[model samples]
Target: MGEVLVLTAAAGVPDAAAAGVAGRATRLAPGAIEVALDRPLPAGFAVPGVDANVVPAERRRKRLLIADMDSTIIGVECIDELADFAGVKAEVAAITERAMRGELDFEAALDARVALLAGLPESVLGECYAERVRLNPGARTLVRTMAALGAETALISGGFSYFTGRVAADAGFARNQANTLLVEGGRLTGRVARPILGRAAKLAALEAITAERGIGVADAIAVGDGANDLDMVRAAGIGVAYHAKPALAAEADARLEHSDLTALLALQGIAADAWVD
Candidate 1:
């Protein structure tokens, strides 16, 4: 199969840095390069500070975009924010840290954290949405550009649908999927709906959406920063670990260490000038 190396940076990758790398190169952006490989890129061949990908020519631009919400799209962890409202931020955040790091089982950790918010006023959900939730940089552009091109965008998160729904609408996704939080009489029921949407659920969502769109997982590009996202991330044609945890970043096909979410666009050959509003 044909191959290409995309080298990208937030600050810009210089021409000198492109030396000794194989391929006939074109600049995809001020900070990105698209190198048409004469042969496969050497193992361990990497630039000092740019994100690089050795992708097949046919897999360059994906038709399906499946993204993870929470830390991937939004700036804060939804549970951690709710924990803060419940006066258990430190305790819950500790579990969140380990869970994301792959040190703890995600489902059990989510259960434990959600349990700490037992009896919290349901109004805090709206309060957290209004006061603490903010989309990450480049979130809108990625979704808009993909949708504008006739590709489908879906936001699947391990977080609650409450936030995903709002984020999906604002970020321009065509659909969204997330777990449901059980609430009662203006307070948390100290429980979430059963069959929690953990790692397996994320992969299933990706599969179901790709099938609906008449594409395989290889036609989709998935991005996330958590351990529960590992399956979906690895299954996608292009899996990105965006400011990710150690376990994920170590295994993902691409790592967005320097660039923001828009970097995914550059990776797919979409330039800033061509980005949709």
Candidate 2:
């Protein structure tokens, strides 16, 4: 009755037994294996191209999902894409990199980037969404499949609400939250609404939602790819760093580098056939 180590690959199931790990290996899906372990994972134990996670088997599946939208669920960072429309992509993207890496304060970075887009046309938001925004592979399946199983789903972001609202619908999240971009005279007002949704806000959303659902914080799974997502990710029962920056990856309970979002389901012992389209 020890913990289980979940090994998930992007293709075929990895052979944990063959890797010299001592355990009873169980295949959960085509590309997933669970190894029951009585002791800590041996030093340097790894399988090429496979992401591994060790957790109590009893807490494998979560009842709530709190996900960061930009660069985690979506392929592009919304602010960076919006900056492109404002002719400041290079400038803004640099700050974004630093912020995601935990080198810069998230709120300050957001303020500087939005300030650079002060005069951009409001219509440019639509242009960026149409031209640059896209759901990363397996995003919809991950959200919809979890929702199908009666779990609550929320998309929260440090990015603006405009993109989160649209992405949440496309990805089938039950609700969404993000900072509001202030607009005036058909152009950006060079400011976000007060009380910006930064790292602290993301953590608060996780707390509020879980409380509203009458579930413990440990009943949630939080996923993201930035430093802004660290708080809630660390607090959740399962915290995943999805193709993340090094800062987040270092602290995540599970890291998905080679596989897609469906791998999260695999970690939860859900097979591919049960996924919702």
Candidate 3:
């Protein structure tokens, strides 16, 4: 068999023939189609609001999933939300935008943003998570479904651990890792812990987890939405850019433009009926 072209849309199923893709079509879900193709689609072919990718039939389902947290699994950037509680949201969010777009050093941008929040009460962490953070649509289903099938799921982020821990548990990830924010005397110390978790650390987590599972990097799938996620996204067998920044999106094996997180399951050939919700 040649490569399988998987198409997922947020609304209706896309027509393979319309895109000049010839193959045996199988409906993986209401808005997902998998086609066994002898030839790749024409160059520049795309359907608005649809995500497309071609993968080897034998390697569609991955054994491990390593994903980013802020702006990927969850709907908001935790740092930006934390900054909001300190009355510096606009200033901090601008830095965050640049950092995610690959224009600023992750650690430096993080330090600058955290510094702006110094003196804010530590209780804001819990309040920010409770009032501002939310898992994006289908996030829970995606993680839980993968875990149910015996895949190891991990949430790795450059964002803070306080948020990662809660998001990971809410989304059903088996494990989680992230940088730590230091608090002193019930107030922000304005410093992230030493040896921050950035792009390199995210990649290291992928490598470490795959090794512990006795599998190659090719057995893993990674998804994220920022430049900080570039290393691991490129290292995984199936790297998905989930509503990503342009830099990361350009390098991803698949881009999820309109669909929610369940699209990842469809990309791996899991039928909608089999999704855990």
Candidate 4:
């Protein structure tokens, strides 16, 4: 398993950056190149618009994909948008930020935020989904491509099941798991169901989902953007932080700051032209 540098940039790998490569670039797409180097990446070697990952050509593609829903797959945090109906967007979004950054306890933060939504009509959830919730760039390509390649895909979230169920169906995820929001008489009870699905449950779901596919944790790739996703992100062999929170970006194996969710496909040696719609 020699070092392979995959750079995604317009000017491509500057001659200075590919100093130790033993092979020529096999262009995966515009601005993306794969070069096998005789030696490992040098210390502090980095280029702008270039994402360098040293992976074995054989183990690049993963058999399982576990992804976080909010701010990773979808563009907005569902809870924050739903809170707008209750006129508590600022209050709930603040908590959502802290929870994602790892500064606040996940379950407690979720409980406090949901408590603020008490008494809002449950129909607002639908409105928020239709108008506020949106798929991030490259979300479908990432999932559809992996699923097309025989990988098992799952959407796991600390968000409510209402959104996950819809997103899973719309995005073609094989399965999904999430916290259930309690509603009474078409209005939110402002309470989450018992045994809230938090950080631990996410990690557990990762393990369970992969096991069903007859693969171990090392064959899985997990992507997320928040603190609650930290555990599972680290648990997978390929943990990616997609436009992530500071804590998650610092801890995950790779950070996708510039590219969309489809960057995950590049990490797995999939070319842009090969991506599924």
TM-score each candidate.
Answer: 0.94, 0.95, 0.96, 0.93
Q: Compared with the true structure, what per-residue lDDT tens digits does model 2 show for residues 1-277? A: 4788888876766564336667778777767888777677988877778878887788788999899999889999988888888888999999999999999998999999999999899999999999988898889999999999999999999999999999999999999999999999999999999899999999999999999999999999999999999999999999999999999999988999877888888777787778998
User: What lDDT score is found at residue 51 in candidate 2?
Assistant: 79
Give the residue spans of candidate 4 off by over 4 A. 9-23
lDDT of 3 by residue, 1-277 (tens): 5688888877867565235677788888877888888777778877767777787788889999999999999999999999888899999999999999999999999999989989989999999999999999889999999999999999999999999999999999999999899999999899999999999999999999999999999999999999999999999999999999999999999988888888899889999888888
Better of 1 and 3 by TM-score: 3
> Could you arrange the candidates by TM-score from highest to lowest?
3, 2, 1, 4
Q: Which stretches of candidate 3 lie over 4 Å from their true place?
A: 14-20
Query: Residue-pair clashes per candidate, as listed?
Result: 0, 0, 0, 0
Give the Å shift of residue 195 in candidate 2: 1.2
The lowest-lDDT stretch of 10 consecutive residues in candidate 3 is: 12-21
Give per-residue CA lDDT, model 4, range 25-71, as digits (tens).
Answer: 67666646677666666688777666666656668789998999999
Task: Please name the candidate that would achieve the greatest lDDT relative to the true structure.
Answer: 3
* Of candidates 4 and 2, the better by lDDT: 2
Q: Ten residues in a row with the worst lDDT in model 1?
A: 51-60
Best by TM-score: 3
Cα shift from native, residue 16, model 3 (Å): 6.8
